[model samples]
Target: MNRRELREQIFMLLFRVEFNQKDDMPEQCTLFLEDGDTEISEKDAAYIRSKYEKIAEKLPEIDKLINETAIGWDTQRMGKVELTIIRLAVYEIRFDETVPTGVAINEAVELAKKFGQEGSSGFVNGILAKFA
Candidate 1:
């Protein structure tokens, strides 16, 4: 898979965290890879898992940043899909040096357009742009 495809997979995997318990995520992640609609290379799967875990590990910090940046729109009140996209973008912006801030924001906007409500992309771009 290409970088965008792998990021999509990582987004999908990270999306699962909002629904499943911590204890169930290991199995869920495995099932997500094994039962996905498209086949990904083992290396790609490993990359997705690692990036997902890294983002998961930093969720508290991520949310804190969002909470501070977004005024009244605390994470608990944000739409789940929007929050997930924001989390992924925040990780790329703050933790992953390889991703330029502009690319991260753009990708998050793309993900929001794909998976979120009609206005979600605008909301995502507004929030992420503050970081850039």
Candidate 2:
């Protein structure tokens, strides 16, 4: 899988964090990789799991940043899809130096377009622009 595909998988896994109990995430992540339609190689699967774990570790900090940057928007009140996209983008922007900030923001916008509501792209762009 390409980097974009990996990112989408990571995002999907991260999205589950909102709904699943923390204890179940490990099992859920494993199932997600094993039960997918497209077969991900072991190497790529490891990469996805590692990134997801890192992002999950930093979620409190990530949500804090989102709480601070998003004017008039509480992290808990934000749409789940938008929040997940923002969390992934924030991780890329702040923790993953390999990903350029612009690319991270652009990719978040794309993810928002795919999984978020109609205005989600613009909303995500607006929030992420604070970091830019």
Q: Which candidate tops lDDT?
A: 2
lDDT (C-alpha, whole model) for all candidates = 0.92, 0.95
User: What TM-score do all the candidates reach, one by one?
Assistant: 0.97, 0.98
Cα displacement (angstroms), candidate 2, residue 8, comes to 0.5
* Model 1 segments more than 4 A misplaced: none
Error of 1 at 90 (Å): 0.4
Report backbone clashes per prediction: 0, 0
Give the total clashing residue pairs for model 2: 0
Residues 1-132 of candidate 2: C-alpha lDDT, one tens digit per residue? 898999999999899999999999999999999997779999999999999999999999999999999999978899999999999999999999999999999999999999999999999999999998
lDDT of 2: 0.95
Model 1 residue 35 lDDT? 94
